[model samples]
Target: MMTRLKIGACLTLDTLPDHRDWIFEADRDLELQDFLSHAALTTDRDVLIERARQALDGFRGKLSIHGPFEGLDIDNKDPELRPVITARFLSALEVADRIGARKMVVHSPYTLWYQNNLHSYPGYAETKLARIHDVLGPVLRRAEELGITLVIENIQDVRPETRRAMVDSFGSDAMALSIDTGHAQLARRMSGAPPVEDFVRDAGAQLAHVHLQDVDGHADRHWAPGEGEIEWSAVFRAIAECEAPPHLVLELRDATHIPAGFAYLRDRGLAV
Candidate 1:
């Protein structure tokens, strides 16, 4: 049996717009119950486990998961908010455990605005990171107990130095790098840092997961592979050269685009 690369989508159950737009829309519609209703109707733990089994039934591939993206803040500074985030993280891990997913992706929860606006705050990044470590430490310990891998992704304009700092602070192999292709593209465009491939190669030893998507040199629209402007072939080559290739998860915004993405990888002789 030929080995296939694990292809998974982010936990984007609803079609909400970008974060900024969502905040503005929410402010306008105070009575909007659509968000809660949508969440209530989507797959629960049991349902997700079954779905995972069904999705991977015949495919000779590894399994991974992208945890819920919305309304989760692992780096919240508020003491009252920490438990809620921790609970959600554990719940996500439960789903991963049920589905036999080896890796789960998580974000630091601080947006570009939060970082930029708080530049004057004392120990800004350190405080947030330490809070994150405190919140994630137990969750990761539990994941380790359950034999699950948690991969942290870099988002917004967070510098590579900060990324490395966050990862090192976590202090575990379970907490490794999850390179988001679109985010890397955005970083390169804005900062003129090394290309995405270079970042992946430099973090090769610590890479544990990847979020595959395309961006049109501006925003991360999560376009299907080859639809936007990412060099998919070069990415595959980089992964192939890694000491241990990270699990590649297709973080497309839409499920309908998954098949085409898989086909593109297949055409490149990369398992999917």
Candidate 2:
């Protein structure tokens, strides 16, 4: 059986038109990245949101936005930081709501240190998890009310299961898991994490979205699918078992390479 999933693109207004025709499918997501810009989310908020709104005027495909994540840890322990982080997230979700997005991508905070030490340090897991729920609680309620799902994407995560556990704790449909192929590759190389393919199977049905990019396994190169060392076939095979029918987003560092990346998957009969 062919699990031919639709491939999508992560784009800014500047690159959206460049890849617009290629991203015409209704289920093929266009992950907007402009909102992730600090300036765009803060002082220039309306201007950039209007720019994005205008750029998406005629497109009817599913939409998802990369939420603002730079230093905005969802589970920050400092009480003072919680509201600040909460406010920033809600601010970004407003953009998501305005853009008619059903999904938003947020970064994960799991690390190898946490994975190894959470048990050793009593109440450590609870502290972080409580912080997460407290911070994300409002944003999640808004996301659910707006019919949006916040997919937790892996970054420096060496432990996918722990992240999954964290996602599961929310016990809400508005929360799910996301895997960044390039991030997984980097984690595998630097921290002895499982292979990128395993990350997919590990996320299983809760996997709501994916960021497809290739890396040299040394750094986040974010190259087109075939431009790096990733095994595309193995990755897609793993993706097929995901019951969420996860949104496969081509999140290249160079957005212009999207067509080539999509074709690489198509030529190999990996994605539809």
Candidate 3:
């Protein structure tokens, strides 16, 4: 049997012209923020919601949202900032429910700096993991209440074990994993992190979403899949073997590169 999966594109205003029949992960921008922030809910969000409804009126496919994580850390130990971060995540979750997003992609808090000095401080990882649970426990419960899957995406995670541990700790059906190929590649080349395949291999059945992009082995190039030096065959092979295929999202930097990305997958006989 051929490798079959629900392939999707990241939805940006510039790329909406090419968004026929493809599943989509809503892009983060001013519009999304307006809907996600409690402060902007009344005036700014009302207009954006109407516009979004009109724009997506004819679209027929599954939807996901990328939750806010720019400066928010679920593992933050600060007493004052912890509540603030929790509120932001709660807001994001509410927005996800309103938009009919079945899944929300959140960034992992594991960082390169922390990993580099992890050995010096014994049990630090465990403590941080506990903090993460404490902060996100309610959010995860709320997501479960809303029938949404909370997918944790690897950002600067040098190794998969820490993140895998955190996800396992949740023990909620609503909690899952996401793999960003470009971010994983950049972590490996720039920080001597594990190979990109390691993430898919470890995530296994827990994988629920993906950010499929090409990288030049150093920076987050986000080029078309075939335009960079990533080993595509191994990546696809790993994905094909998953117990349940994840949502493959073409999250390219430019809208113009999306067709080329789809073409690359087609040429490889991996298109769904």
Top candidate (lDDT) = 2
Residue by residue across 196-230, what tens digits does model 2's lDDT show? Answer: 99999999989989999999989999999998888
The residue-by-residue lDDT of candidate 1 on 1-272, one tens digit each, is 33445454443323222222322322211011121222422444565456445644443345566665566677777888888777777877777676566777777564556546676887776787778887888899988898888877877644555666677876777778878888888877865656777768767778877778888878888887878888776776777777886766667777567668767877766654
RMSD each, Å: 9.4, 1.5, 3.6
lDDT for 80 in candidate 3 is 88
On the 0 to 100 scale, the lDDT of residue 143 in model 2 is 90
Of the pair 1 and 3, which is ahead by TM-score? 3
> Please, what are the lDDT tens digits per residue for candidate 3 over residues 166-231?
899889889999999999988888889777887899889998888889999878888989988777
Q: Cα RMSD for candidate 1?
A: 9.4
List the candidates ranked by lDDT, beginning with the highest. 2, 3, 1
Ranking by TM-score: 2, 3, 1
For each candidate, give its TM-score against the true structure. Answer: 0.75, 0.95, 0.89
lDDT of each: 0.65, 0.88, 0.76
